[model samples]
Target: MLFGKKKEKVHFNPGNRDDGVDENFVEETVNKIDEDDVEVVLKNEENIDKKFSGNNSLSKYMELGRIMVSMLKDVKNGRYKNIPWFTIATVVMALLYVLNPMDIVPDFIPGVGYIDDVAVLTMGVGWIESDLHRYLDWRLENDLGI
Candidate 1:
């Protein structure tokens, strides 16, 4: 029987993927955030801009989530180019990781569990920080009507 060539597997390892995010950094950052106390980070960039400040880590966390959304949106709108595949994968994976009920640490665990989600978000943001900054600058310029 003839058949097409078998496709290579594409694995996305959130803990140690490319785009420069290492496990060490993610673990360290995750340990610092009080996941149990995390609240709504932000509703919009303007809110982040106005409300993000020193000692406001929750807001920054939300900002990272929003940045992921914005990046995905920009990709859909054809505003981004040459985006690294790992970056895209990281964002989608992180988003999914956050919502997945069955993870290394389940979300229903209450206090300590959300830390995993936060860790995913934090590391995902770290991997795509430059891309996020570029998108953020573009967004700010366009939003300002400049």
Candidate 2:
């Protein structure tokens, strides 16, 4: 404790009642975003690698990113058709949010920039946990890497 202020632990509130996430807005944002955009993002894992490099402090969001990567890969290859459009939209929206540096908090803050991103992601993935876990397990079972 010699040189700087202790960073406040940014708590993520995933809501108690209905998780407090505005699903409609998330869906609309996803719907408005071009599928090409999502594809572009999904296609460029280097971009994802770069984005993840900038903020390693938030693993939860990164985990979400991994989930999205799996989903995106499946969708791109025509191997999985069971993903609902809403889920796809939400995952794409989270990826877009992470790539944006000037979100609810600017990424230049050094210590607090990615808090909102983490919160957004934690909430975004709340409803999709089962699907993600299933996909993750399937990947494990099938020895898929991406």
Candidate 3:
């Protein structure tokens, strides 16, 4: 008789979509990033190559960093949250590239390996640009600028 007990029903309801934080919104924003923007960001080697300013450009970088944290938090809180697949893909690919014995351009060639890391990360970060903008606005409103 104990084994025959009925299982409870599971219900699912998608959360509100108005907030810019929605995964669909983030995904759409990332998908819209074009080659020109990539080129612009990449061409400025100073921006890409230099170590992230301790505080300068801090807001933009923090915006991205926050989204990553927030996504994890939301998921932990039982919300129907989803991280954009592309972000995961980029990170995984980068890690795989590192683990593989062979590389497109060996790390032995100074600067090239770091450049590849920057490029992949830049693309992943750029995907969440819209969320970053929202995060920046929040930082600005709260006077949190670096």
Candidate 4:
């Protein structure tokens, strides 16, 4: 009977399904998308670097709390004055991480982790290394060992 066939229960299990459908398809698709996305992002970032790496502002204190703390300590101790743009970038990224509605690793997944936050933070730090010395030196001279 049509209704009887519809009512019959059919169970599909990834490990035990008798049909030739490969259960790993879903996992493979997700992995491929992740890889492709990463490559595209890297290319885009490289292009952006060539255009606007200069004249960027430092991140706000709230965004770069640790860096801010360090800089602030230096300021109080008379060691530094202005925070660097890279430092600001790190903070801005942090702010995005904390406040952004979208997560690098979507929150829905149970086991996998997030890496976008780390990537941005790393880029920011690397960008700031060269200017760090100059900023620190200026702070030291103006703040008298802060």
Instruction: Give the best candidate by TM-score.
Output: 2
Question: Residue-wise lDDT of candidate 3 within 1-146, one digit each (tens)?
Answer: 11122222222112443333355544454444443333333344343223333345434543444344343333334341233434333323333333332466654565454345444445555554554455446546656562
Tell me each candidate's TM-score: 0.56, 0.74, 0.33, 0.33
Per-model CA lDDT versus the true structure: 0.54, 0.64, 0.39, 0.38
Clashing residue pairs, candidate 2?
Answer: none
How does candidate 1 fare on TM-score?
0.56
**Model 1 C-alpha lDDT per residue in residues 1-146, reported as the tens digit of each score:** 00111222234445455656555654444333331212222123344333223235556666666667566556545565535545555566666556566788885675665677777777677767777777678778778211
* lDDT (C-alpha) at residue 106 in model 3: 57
Instruction: Give me the overall lDDT of model 1.
Output: 0.54
**Which segments of model 2 are wrong by more than 4 Å?**
1-17, 54-56
TM-score of 3: 0.33
Cα error, residue 9 of model 2, in Å, equals: 38
Consecutive 10-residue window with the lowest summed lDDT within model 1: 1-10
Tens-digit lDDT string for candidate 2 (23-57): 55655565565566667668765665566565556
Ranking by lDDT: 2, 1, 3, 4
Per residue, candidate 4 scores C-alpha lDDT tens digits across 1-146 of 11111222222233433544443542343223322232333334333232222223322322333443354345334444354322433333443443332577752343332244344444444545445556556656666442
With a 3 Å backbone cut-off (N, CA, C), the pairs that clash in candidate 1 are none
lDDT at residue 45 of model 1 (Cα atoms): 36
Off by over 4 Å in 3: 1-108
* lDDT value for model 4: 0.38
For model 3, where is the 10-residue window of minimal lDDT? 1-10
